[model samples]
Target chain A: MLTLVSRNSPAAPSGNRRRRSIEGGWKQITINRAFLLPAVVVFVFLFIIPLAQGFYWSLTDFTGYNPEANFIGMANYAEILRDPSMLSALAFTVLFAVGTTVIVTCLAIPLAVQLNKVFLGRNFVRSLWFFPAVPSMAILGLVWSYILSPLPSGVLNTTLNNWFGIDAVSWLSDNSLARMSVILVGVWAQVGWHAVLYVAYLQAIPTEYYEVAKIDGASARQQFFSITLPLLTPAMVISSFLLLTGGLKVFELPYTLTNGGPGFATNTITQALITSGVSQGRYGLASALAVMFTIVVAIVGFSQLKVTTMISRRFS
Target chain B: MKSRALRVLALAAGASLTFAVAGCGSGGADDGTTTVSFLSWTGQEQMEPMIEAFQEANPDVRIEASYAPPVAEYIQTLQTRVLSGTAPDVFVVAAENKTNLIQSGAVVDLTGEPFMEGVQSFNLDTYGSDGAQYGLSLSSWAAGYAYNEDMLAEVGYDGIPETWDEFLTMLQKLKDAGHTPFLESVDQMPTTVSAMLGAQTAQMDPAMDELIFSGESTFAEQWTPILEDYNQLYTEDLVSSDVVALDGDQVRDEFANERVAVINAGPWIINAVEEANPDLNWSFAQVPGRDGGMPFQAGAAAPGYAISANADEETQAAAKTFLTWLASEDGVQMFHEATNDVTVTDNFQPEVNPVFEPLVEPIREGELYLPMISWQRDEDRLNIEVVAQIQRMIQGAVSPEQVASALDSQLSGS
Candidate 1:
């Protein structure tokens, strides 16, 4: 007592037991790390190695067919900066990503609330909403291209003419209209799936909280703002993140619908990548564009995650 | 126990490694027959019969054929295989990849191969460079105006006119008779513009593209007039600017449904349009020229077969035998029956549909032009720029001069 003997003193039996426990813990840690080896190998080979190779290719004039590519540092980046079509592609890509994310979130939340209510043919209606999400964006785009065709014989235009006697509107011909139509169709295609995600989260909220709020004379709107909205923040984070990333990577819809046309009004960065890298054989230049696009996507993604995480923390 | 577990894992890994090593064995058999790997541009349905015929005729040479559909998928697949040194012994060399294949020395030159003889020179030159042929092109296709006979009859014109002025007049009459006059999908290089450029270039000694590419001329100087003339369809309100948003299939549908009078079409559309409307009377006509130019058609030779440069001498010889058989009269006939393509080989005359008869002569004579096929370099890049700028021109966002100037800038890489 006077010496304040440590538990690990060599003279004590408990010290020996502690030593054995430490040795067993080390062995367990070794086994755990061994279990992680395959995953680490896969990550390095697939993601890290390809990323490094792509970065190396970005600095060269590597026409896809040629193996002996000459190092032409920054020429490809400089070319991308000067190209107007590429710039237009960047602008439209950003527009589509932000537009679809904002619009789908706004509509999907309200739609989920409505779909949560008991109604006639509720399953049928839910299925109808989810149907668009079932088909590929490419197929949906083709079908909608016919529906949104600017001609008088188009499905929507014909309906409008027959019902309202209105002239055919150029849904995909005019620049602004084409951009808007693509974004709207994108929203329509995704809103239902995102709503289903919200519905799952909505169902998890306990009924006790709402009952207590009702007993306190809390208005429906106030209770919703305080309870439903706060708890839905987690779903918002997931849904918005998906919408943003998917929209940023969009290629098939605008490609099949307008083919990035009416003069680059609907061109996407992904389309530009394919056109340059695969179609034109300018792999180096495409790599540079891809590098820039990746940085942009990362920045946007991280910013969104940070904002959503802060919201979640505050709400929780 | 742990060591026993490790032993099991080691045994499994050893088994996997052995199987993978065995999988990398050579493509050969105990028999003396040589196997030639081929990547066909034609679809499997159309290519299988021809491959079967070749293997039957050449008992000693076997074609191990695979297919990727044209034009983008085939190009990308071939490019990847060539780069990886796993390319087929034989493959297609299309306009899209001809320059790359030649520059990288991935294709064998067939300049004076016996298989190259009797093929159309224009078709050969399409996939050649500096007097060396690299592809065995067997057929050609041309796109021209397919007009509705009944609609034209209603407008008091039996055929598309021979000049731009008359064509416009006919279009106006069709419009006044309550019909959509003309629709050429500007989604690509418009057939009208290509045919017009073909007419103008057909008269030049140095050739228009040669002059422009060699830096003796510029797109602004050679293309502005043609652009202005072609823009009249929109500016004069004979054709809708909305055609910028239309694809070939849409325009063809409009023609098939009897809503539009004329649409740019090739032999590929013959069956679909006929099936869509059996009662619709239609015939093809050359795209009219402008300002004292000959009537011309926008077309290119179909993608051609080429031997891979990386293949061994025996494999290459087998590849050549396959191509030679493909170019033979019987082979061409079999191919024509399978695909219904307009065959351009000297020995066999393809029997095309009656509605596609008018454009067949031009195809056979190789009197057709496609700018992408003829461009010396930067063909895809220039094609993209031109199509976009022309769309802008149709939208009235840019003038004809601006469209031509954009091409000039793109070519100069400014």
Candidate 2:
């Protein structure tokens, strides 16, 4: 409606009158504003409103089942900080985020580089690599649970035992191994998808740069280091940012795989949040944990984004 | 043409928004008859017939029903609906959410209701708080170790032993007979451990959690021995430590395949076990006693039917009718026939499978326990923590004492 009004206000035909030019600019502004209206409405209603409600609930004693609850100041937040389980969850969440980010980035870039090359049955290989990400994480977690089951009946354990005469390894029972198994499955599920993203970015880079490097007596390794690696930095920036945030909020994989057990070895903050808020009816404390989690994630995500962007710019 | 297309798009969008708004509204009709909306945690196949039966019996009350799958999903759906003031007139109050439901006054108090008469007091009190009943629980479930008859006979035992030592001896004999002795899923609380603790706590002056929360006793003191006794399977190398990574389904499968002679299971597994190996003879028994304590089973009242306190008088009345009918012998018999749950109403005795005959008396008499159902407060949080710590204990990362103290810390922190 505003776009139509602004369009009609500019009445001068073809002539560059100042009033007409001003109205034309107004017409452009109105169109842009009109285009953004739906998104802004969605953002305010879906994101901003819920966030404000969460912030309010964090300061209240809302038990999730009740609509009427008293404001309790910062007791929930204070309690969360003092809680040991939350601290353990926080530690593992950070470790998972950082570990998955570093490891997946290292693996994805190389995988993408290889996937970019022409080979026999290249499409099949690419599809095979990408298939893990196609299924939901919950399904993958269940599948991996069976594959990595500590029993000799598990697929991998049975293979190891029958083929090599090895004892069954307690893949998800030990604390360190549980954490590592979760991260390993996480890395496996993610590396292909991120590599696919890198593959898209790799396609965008001009062939001339690599061609020039090749012509200048550059080895395959040197060409990759000088050109391909530099060009893939933007993908790295986006990929790492996503991995960091998603890893921080991860619940299902760890939940289905080990249920944050063998104790709270692989428990993430979001799992804590869900268990407290949804399952345990401690919505107030969960909201507080959520608020703290959001702040931590935002700080880490934004800082990592800034660092990666700077690095990418330097490389460019 | 472009302008026409834009107009068409706008019309479609407006129509969709209208449909979306209309779709989100409550489905219960109000056409002179009372329409009581019900949300069931049980699946539609189990609940639909009951709704049909209720609607047939009470023509003035129209029954509208929906379902959310059990446990976490059901609790979350009910919670969201209750907080939004859109909860159904009737819903299931599960162990995990009964505390919240009662404390928030979200459920109707069924105290002194005629429908509650003859209903098992244990089932009623499971969802009750402060001497007021909120949920009309109809049936209860008990889980214990189901053993293969042939396997036990091969080891020269006709039935499971009453004491822990004799049971371990039987397990060792089975192992020595070239058979896999036992398997219990440690995904949640171990059945053997919970049952042992249940037997002990049932005999205590005050209930276990009551004494612990009152500061008269500590979990570290009370639970350490139970933990040690339960952990002896692993310590004595009678059961494989790999059971830590197993779940109920896997254990059930192992039993079905005849790879294992015993497994922790409940009536829920009866059909599957029968279907898997009909020729194989199996029977259920309570977990063995320790230190002369009576054998007990890890069990609880089934999640119950509770009316919403916020419902209109008409809907509430209709919901009461539904609950009364549910507690009635006919309703109990139908429910039992459908779900095979041990109905606990005094007037009704659900016919049991011969295999489950051992548990029939206990279920009827309400001699079952689950820590989640019995705990006075912080039940869900404590259960999660305790389960995780127990898993840790099974993995040898933490001692039984540390695991018990973790509960202490969790309770104090909460």
Candidate 3:
């Protein structure tokens, strides 16, 4: 509509003048587009080329050792589809991605709101919450494994037994509990960072809006719902996107904690990819899995963006 | 601005010249010494002394060593190098990569090398195909039950039993005495199952893996009974099923702290266990056998040094010289003192810890078997299936027969 208005304006330039203006605009545009060359090069080299190579390898039996692999065509994909463990891995990967995203978002916002208040030692509290994000997930997983071990001597189990006479729980041995433990540990590791993101967004919200709400006799809860929640949609979009993608790509936490057992209960696609490609030397099959996983991630990521955009529009 | 540009170019030229000179210095100094690049599987602290000893003995060969930690990282690094045509002059050929290395002709055959003479045939055969030995393996390792002597004595046993039935009875006795009988990490293949399978194979005319891989037998036919026997540890409620969640370190800690009576372990745990509890009375015993088979261990030759086929003849010869010294008595002694591994070369007797002495003979005599090392092909894939399925069996989600049949299905890719 704006383009149409500009085009139909009554005081438009003459034809020769417009020609000269467009020529000038073309040179300006060329210079501007030249600034994008480095980024384009990086994207091509880092993402697109590797993606294309992976797709090509997906159609062959390129074990990591030899370059002269035979073209096998769809066999790797078919094998993935047929394998029960691979299917289970897919199920758990989706569950983890969706589970952590929802739980973390639900928990992080309230935590962020509480942390945003002018409480005593606010900086210390924020730092305390953010400490879990400092260490690698692999380290956290190792520590949590010992804490949540199923033995009577485990840290959590021993505490429970001492304090409440509770029995040992199979934290990592049972399928459902193992999945839940991994997701919870993931949430523990990431919730602080996401909350910090929310706190940043919360700080950006104009203070005058809340003052005006107070003058209108709005209560704290009413003011929050009307003023704060609507404006935080953009933050939600970014945080949830990050959470979903990180959760999907999770490998180390589950790997160090459960080693994807007691029957692949916490297996992730990335674990399968590494195990097959690097450890088993079945790079072709791993490439096929990677390609499929990429498609899945793209679909989920875009669908999330669409939903978040719709929510943002509704709130706006 | 022109002067600044000239200064930057001059600095860059100086840096390039320095790097070129340093690169030249890394190799032999053109003094008839040949530099052999080695990608070591051992950590730097352990491998450095062995390299120094070898270089001191053979001054003509300068060892340029780089280290990658074992198993996955080392394999991936070496694989990338081999494919990119930048592999070291010598690298460790492990069970994980032996088949691929041999099939791709990435390693030179060391069958007739004098250094290969005193090494055990089992070590040679592990990295060989069709009688062409490729790796000089100087050491072997075995895993068995590392039992706490005090706890076993409390249960009226001085050592681990030699038969499965007696072992189960002892476990029951220990449990009755309010003690944890055994703990074996099922994160990898269970040591108990591997030992039982080894015992079974030792008595078979053709090795069990040979029959199964040759298609004359199936996992269901040969492995179901053993799987059932192993499952007894969990099913009879003697040992906890939570072991599926435990790793070797956790189990070792339990034994070290005297919280568990016995745990399946290898020599690698010796230092940690001793350090954790210096006065802990412990000894290693072969895993008990079943149905009158002899006791055996789950073990294999340690990763061996293989000269790269891609190296030039001179560097390859230098690599060979390194391996020859590595297999010598003095070199083996230094390696043993550094790494605490039982060297299997006949020229040197590795003085093992007294607690670990019982399993050392079997390691030296090559009476060890690990399914991943013995499988003809698809080792990693089959290993993953076995572990997961066995965990499922322990959890009561699958039967022993189903677990064995799952391997058959995995092997057939069905």
Candidate 4:
């Protein structure tokens, strides 16, 4: 309504005139600003403001409950760094972030390529792959908990025991195995959704490029490397950033799977922040951890954003 | 055209955001009849009948309830809701939130509310502070080792030992017979400390809590011996530190399905055990402690209804009416029948699952005291520390005394 009203009046024409005047020297700024206004609004309101609030809280010892909190400077950061559990959770979180990003990217591309082809029950296959991401993590966790139970009576273990004549494996008990199992489950839950994402982007690539390469007597592999790979770089940048942040901020799956232990083996930074801040009533400490975590996350996120843009620009 | 394509992409992303936010902001309440979102930690199947009873009783109060499993998830979900001001009018505030729930003004403080009439003091005190009750606790639970009777016979022990020393000796005998003696999940803090503390409370002129909180003695002074005594199983190689890596559910699963003689468990898991291994020989017993000490339990009061302080007098009264009915004979029976809890009210003697009978008395009689439950300070913080320190203790990374001392330091730190 406001936009319509403004457009209908003569006053906005002068505003547009001012814009045109500035467009000579600041033309790119006007263009970029116009193009990005809607997205900027969304990113600022939903993401930026909340992140700023979170960062501010991190600086203060903002116990989640108290209406009043005091600024404790870098005390929270100092404590979190010194604390062993948070460090362990951070280490595991990084491993998980890197592991899933590398593994899922490799898996999803191939999986998307296969699904994009005409095959028997192709739709059915696609749905089956996508099914894990459909359910809430809580439900999936309950189901997977039983399946990954360390006992011989556990679903997978019992099946493996009978079918393969093997002993029961403690999928969630041993520290390293628990970490691996959590990562494996994470990949299982997410890879399909990501594959579907790649599928959507994959369909967007022009067939003319592939055809042109074929017309040049290029083999399928040659065409993929010369044409398809370069085009997919933009999508890769987007997908990898999502995966990195998603994996870093992962809480539900690991919490559901292991509750951050055998002994803090599979804990994540967010989980530690939450468990300490909310459950323990150390909101101030928690907010501090959160604030610091946000800074770290922002640093990582911005660096990845820069790297992805560069890669995409190189491809362009 | 490029901008149009970007717009299409943006719209798609926005649509997915709608989907994502929709999933969380609303938790799948489809029947959609003025849904009163009830957040429970109870299992889904267990809540069905109780919900049915509520619907039957108050047809106007169209209820929509969902449960996060238990402990951490339940706490996390409630925290999110409360912090975001999206919490249900009614929600479970177990021991983990007993302090913060009250201090944060998240729960209703029913100091002299009408719904509290005829409610037992033990249940009230479970979720209460000095004089004000925050929750209308409906049930109480006491967990101990669920033992195999036949295994006791094989080890030449007729039943669970009455004394802590006797228990250790019995464990040694079981080890001698080449069986895994006993397994308690150290992924949680030691239940025996709570049971022993409860025992001490029963004998105390004032209480263990009073003395400990008054600084008469520290946790290290009180619990070090108990932890060391408990560690006899590890030191003697009757059981490995493997148990420390396991939680209550895993322990219960092992006891139900494995050849292990005993598993640390509570009444909540009886149904799963019955369904899985109905023929398994099992019965509950109080965890043994120093012989002269009172046979105390390691249980907590069940989550109950709390009147929202923000609600108007009319809504508060209406909510009170509902809660009062829940504590009444019919309501108690209905809820107990559904949840299979050890409901502690003189008004109702619920026909619980037979396996839970052994725990019923201890739970009802108010014969339990866990240190975390009794902590004058932050319960969740101390509990997490204890659980971690205990895990390290069992892993041979730290000594039992060190674990006790760590608790003391953690308690004193903040």
Give the per-residue lDDT digits (tens) of candidate 2, residues B334-411: 898888888898888788888988887887788888887888789988888888888777777789999899888888
What's the alpha carbon RMSD for model 3?
3.8
Q: What TM value does chain B of candidate 1 have?
A: 0.94
Please give the clash total of every predicted structure, in order. Answer: 0, 0, 0, 6
Q: How many pairs of residues in model 1 come into backbone collision?
A: 0
Local accuracy of candidate 1 as per-residue lDDT tens digits, B1-414: 999999999999999999887544324446877888889888899899889888999998888788898888888898898888899999998888899999999999898999889899999999999999999989989999999999999989999889989999999999999999988898999999999999898899999999999999999999999999999999999988888889888888988999999999888888889899999999999999797578999999988899988888888888888889999999899988988888898999888888888999999999999999999988999999999999999999999999989989988982
Tell me, per candidate, how large a share of the native contacts it keeps: 0.74, 0.84, 0.77, 0.42
Give per-residue CA lDDT, model 3, range B1-414, as digits (tens): 999999999999999999887664323555888888889999999989888878778889888888899899999999999999888999999988888889999999999999999999999998888889999888999999999999999978999999999999999999999999999999999999999999999889888998998899999999999999999998899999999899999999999999999999999899999999999998999999898789999999988899888988777777888888888889888888988888898888888789999999999999999999888788889999999999999999999999989999988982
The runs of at least 3 residues in candidate 2 whose Cα sits more than 4 Å from the true structure, single-residue gaps closed, are A1-27, B1-31
lDDT of 2 by residue, A1-316 (tens): 0010112465546656766777769978888799999999999999999999999999998899888889999999999888778899999999999999999999999999899999999899999999998998999999899899887678888999999999989898778888999999999999999999999999998887767666778898987887788878878888998999889989889989988877788888989998999999988999999999889988998899889978976785
lDDT of 4 at B11: 100
Q: Point out the higher-scoring one by DockQ: 1 or 4.
A: 1
DockQ for every model, please.
Answer: 0.67, 0.59, 0.75, 0.24
Q: Candidate 3 at A32: error in angstroms?
A: 1.5
Collision pairs in model 2: none
lDDT of 4 by residue, B147-223 (tens): 88788899787678878878888888877787767878776766776677677677777676677777898878877
User: Candidate 3 residues A1-316, lDDT tens each?
Assistant: 0010122557978899999988879979899999999999999999999999999999999998988999999999999999899988988999999999999999998899999999889999999999999999999999999999999999999999999999999999899999999999999999999999999999998788887788889999987788788888989999999999988899999999999988888888999999999888899999999999999999999999999999988787
Q: What is the interface RMSD of each candidate, in Å?
A: 0.6, 1.2, 0.6, 3.2
Worst 10 residues of 1 chain A by lDDT: A1-10
Please give, as one word, the docking class of candidate 4: acceptable
User: TM-score for all predictions?
Assistant: 0.94, 0.91, 0.95, 0.77
User: Which 10-residue window in model 3 chain B sums to the lowest lDDT?
Assistant: B21-30
